[model samples]
Target: MFEDKIEKMNENIGTIPMIEYEKRVYTPEEIQDILGVSRTTIYQLIKSKVFHSVRVGGQYRISKRSFDKWLEESDEEL
Candidate 1:
């Protein structure tokens, strides 16, 4: 269901729309929405070091590349 919606949305948006927030990294709330996880789960993943985060000017930012890599490698664990 989610995948179908995502595909349709992407199609409607022409695959690559301009992003106003492209330069800025995502916060926990943004990650939560993107990953379809709860706030607690996001924190747990961060605490367990499953995903690496970096602190910058008092805000922690997750690397999009590293997160994608983790997702790719994580499927093997199941």
Candidate 2:
């Protein structure tokens, strides 16, 4: 009986959809690679508040959404 209950619970769990979340936050190294800029430039931009970012545990994480918005605004300036 216990084995049957365990099997039923496993089946129920399997029926639930497994959701996977994408990484929306990026590190300074990742931003450097994405923007093709140096680490110094990335830090400068962060310090200048040109991009929206959050500092967690002494590290800055930039959101993909904010970066996209910045890109749009920059394009408009040209």
Candidate 3:
């Protein structure tokens, strides 16, 4: 039942656009790869709120915009 609506929605991509917020998130693993850091360090930053993030369900979802802005302002070499 729900699958039919999803299929219909996909077919009408022109009329129904994807949400912008959905594209603005970064996962912990992606952050690790980008920063060359470990999972522990990533969580530490998330906990410290060095950038914007929110706990969704059991895990954290970092904002890509906030993270990039933090990087630009910080002295940390990428």
Candidate 4:
């Protein structure tokens, strides 16, 4: 079922060649690597709701889209 959904999503994306989609959910560790911040900072950001995140089984999952949006907004603020 998962494979089928992925295949269907890929097929849909293939129809729009101009659009590039990366369906990724980042773990806190991965976000830290991307942001060059510590895990504690990541948790703090999650706690402060600096960006959107969903907690699953005591772990927070940050969507790439939200992270990018937050980055863009922060850059504009600066």
lDDT of 3 at 59: 82
Superposed by TM-score, candidate 2 places the C-alpha of residue 13 at a distance from the truth, in angstroms, of 13
Clashing pairs in 1: none
lDDT of 1 by residue, 1-78 (tens): 999999888787765767675533557777899889999998787777777787778877887777777888987888
Model 2 spans > 4 angstroms off:
1-18
Worst 10 residues of 1 by lDDT: 17-26
Per-model TM-score on C-alpha atoms: 0.58, 0.68, 0.66, 0.66
Error of 2 at 24 (Å): 2.2
Cα lDDT tens digits for candidate 4, 1-78: 999999988888757768687867889898899889988899999888877899899888998888889989989999
What order do you get sorting by lDDT, best first? 3, 2, 4, 1
TM-score of 2: 0.68
Largest TM-score belongs to which candidate?
Answer: 2
Residue 2, model 3, lDDT: 100
Q: Candidate 4: minimum summed lDDT over ten consecutive residues — where?
A: 14-23
- Looking at model 4, the pairs that clash are none
State which candidate, 3 or 4, has the greater lDDT. Answer: 3
lDDT of 1: 0.78
lDDT accuracy of residue 52 in candidate 1: 77
lDDT of candidate 2 over 1-78, digit per residue (tens): 999999989989968998999889889899899889999999998888887899999999998888879978999999
Candidate lDDT values, in order? 0.78, 0.89, 0.91, 0.87
Give per-residue CA lDDT, model 3, range 1-78, as digits (tens).
999999988898788766775569899999999999999999999999999999899888999999999988885665
